[model samples]
Target: MKQKTIGLLGGCSNVATAEYYRFLNEAVNTRLGGWEIAETLIAGMNFGNIEAFVRTGDWDGLGRYMKTKIDGLVAGGADVILCVSNTLHKPLEDLMDRGGVPMIHIADPTGVAMSAAGLSKVAIFGTKPVMEMSYLKDQFQHRFEVQAIAPTEEEQCDIDQIIFDELVKNKLKDTSKARYLEIADRMRREEDAEGLILGCTEIFLLIDQDDRPDFPMFNTARLHCEAAVDFALS
Candidate 1:
């Protein structure tokens, strides 16, 4: 059998990218056994450029940057492409539309996991733009009859501070974990959410199943990585 090649469009911040890479290799090795590792093509871009494009919502600039990344991946013999950042995925649809490469949409696997978990309503925690925009919610709603709940304005700012300023920079603080757990508790109690979806990849850095003991937590990073491993192995 030919070795499958997967492409990763990462470096939105190196932390999430590293997580994806580690998750892919670990999942593949664990499932297949032995020291066999997954083949991957990575194009890590400059964090400054990615942040600038994301802050300004420059679709053209983002598409251009992604194109360069994808070009390198394809040239390196990647069969499928996956973007490591959920926020950066805003421009991904357009890029994949024109690029003719099979890019896995992270939300699809997340919806699958949520559906399998028998969750009717899930609270989404992410940056302000992803929470405010209807992209992820609409996608999930169209596929499944799931309600997507977001954090309040104050909570959004809090998440932004933790994710962008701290977690993405690889500075994990115990206080941030407590704060996220508090927000998760509120969502479960007030929103009546069946599960919590860590919509932002960076969220995994702060909170996990240990923090949200009252409700099931869907780690998007793990979900995305599982899908990528499946695609690569298939």
Candidate 2:
């Protein structure tokens, strides 16, 4: 099979982009079993500008921005696009529907992994945009047959702050991780959640691993990169 160039639309939070790159290279190299590597094209965006549009709720502006960047990626010979951030998947999906480019939704593999694990209900943790937005949550329930529960409004605010103030900046504090685990544990019990979805790309930079050993944790960025590797090698 011929390898395809994976276009990464990243920098919604740079730390998340770094993780995606690392995951892809490691997986691809391990699969090849030699010095081989995946063909990749990275178009990193300005997080400040992207966040401004997100904060203002200007999806049209965001869409146009994404389109422009993606156009450049496609022009540069990217066969498939992967927007590394979960929140960016909203416009990215819209673009895909319009036949803009072949892009992967970050939630797709998470839903698949959950379904295979017999997980019906899961708690979601992410930035306010990712958690509060029903696009991904609705997709999980309707398309993948997985029910998702987000943290409380108060908890959502905390998650958002940690995402922007800490994770994006590459600051991972033990206290923050403990607080995140506390919220996840509460949701896991209160919502009867079968698992937890790390809905934000930067979230894994905070709380990762099967901390509950018995429970599953879906890391969106890692799963998405794995799926991208699949596409690249197919």
Candidate 3:
């Protein structure tokens, strides 16, 4: 069988895109040994245009724009596609149907992990849309029979600001990390959340399983990359 080329649609923020690239190569080498790496093609867009479409509620325009990007990847011999950002999945839904390549959703693997752990409810922290909208939350409920809990509206704004102002710029602050943990702890204590879904790709930079060893964290980026490698090798 010919090795499939993985297509990455990224640049929702370049910070998370780099993580996806690193994870794919590291995983391939670890599994196959030697210096081997997965065959990959990246179609990165300008974050400015992406955010503009999103902020204006122009999902149709965003979908058209993303379709063009993904079309280029397909032309470049990309066999399967993965959008690095959870938020981008909203615009890429139509592209997934028309692109003719297997597109791995960022939520599926996380949902599987939550289900396997027998978690009925989990706390999610991400960009505004991922938390406020039904995209990721609905996927978990419908596909895995799991419920997702989001921060309160005020808390959502705080989290969204942290993601755009700090994490996307590749700036990490101890203060922001402290705040995120504080929020997570409150959710766990009050909401009866069974686990945490690090819904945004860049969140792994802020905190991970080690930050709260007593709590479960589902790292969507890691799980998504693992799924990509499995599909590539299979």
Candidate 4:
């Protein structure tokens, strides 16, 4: 199969951005064997700038900023695009509306996985905006018929704090991890959430499927990368 160049619009947090690159290359090599690598283009943005755009609720400005990044990737021969941040998909979709190379929506793969797993309800963990926003929840509902749940407002603040104050900065603490798991447990017990979506790209840094073997967990970053690799090799 001929591989298409995968364009990554990243650095919403350089940590997750780097993981996307590594996951893409490793997946390609595993499939093809013997030093094979994905044809790729990375347009890394300054997180501070992206954060500012998000915080100010400047959707138009964010869309325009991301469009410029996507333009560079297309100019560099990228056949497809993937923005590495879940929260940024709103702007990414705005860019899509204006037309460009084919792009993957990060939530789609996770939604598909949820449907395949027969999960009717799932909890989401992400930045404050991501949890409060409908971008992912609505997508899951409309596309997969899955019910998406976000933690309570207090839980949302705690998760958001950990993401920005620790995970994005590459600081992982056992206390934070424990608190996250406690929240996950509460979601499961109270909301009857059958699974959990690691909605933030950096969330996997704190906890994963291994933390609770029986609970269904969707790591959006890894799922997104796998989907991109599948498309690249298709």
Q: Quote each prediction's TM-score.
A: 0.95, 0.96, 0.97, 0.97
lDDT of 1 at 188: 83
The parts of candidate 4 lying over 4 Å away from their true place are none
Q: Whose lDDT is higher: candidate 3's or candidate 4's?
A: 4
Write candidate 1's Cα lDDT for 1-234 as tens digits.
Answer: 355788999897799899999999899999888887789989999988987887787868888988998889888888888898878778788878877679889888989988988888988888777788888888889997778889898988898788888988999999888888888788888889888888889888788887657688888888888898888877
Tell me the tens digit of each residue's lDDT in model 3 across 1-234.
357899999887888889999999999999988878989999998998987887788989989889888999999999889999998888777778887888999999999999999999999999888999998899999999999999998888889899988998999999999989988999999999888999999998999999999899999999999999999999
Q: Any residue pairs clashing in model 2, and if so which?
A: none
* Local accuracy of candidate 4 as per-residue lDDT tens digits, 1-234: 478999999998899999999999999999999979998899999999888898789988988888888889988989889999999998788687565688999999999999999998999999877899998899999999998999999999999899888998899999999999999999999989999999999999789999999999999999999999999999
Tens-place lDDT per residue, model 2, 105-205, is 88899989999999899999887888998989998999899988889999999999988888899999999999999998898778798889999888877
Which 10-residue span in candidate 1 carries the lowest summed lDDT?
205-214
List the candidate 3 regions with Cα displacement exceeding 4 Å.
Answer: none
Cα RMSDs of all predictions?
A: 1.3, 1.3, 1.1, 1.0
The lDDT for every candidate, in the order shown, is 0.85, 0.88, 0.91, 0.92
Which candidate number has the best lDDT? 4
Q: For candidate 2, what is the lDDT?
A: 0.88
Q: Which ten residues in a row have the lowest lDDT in candidate 3?
A: 91-100
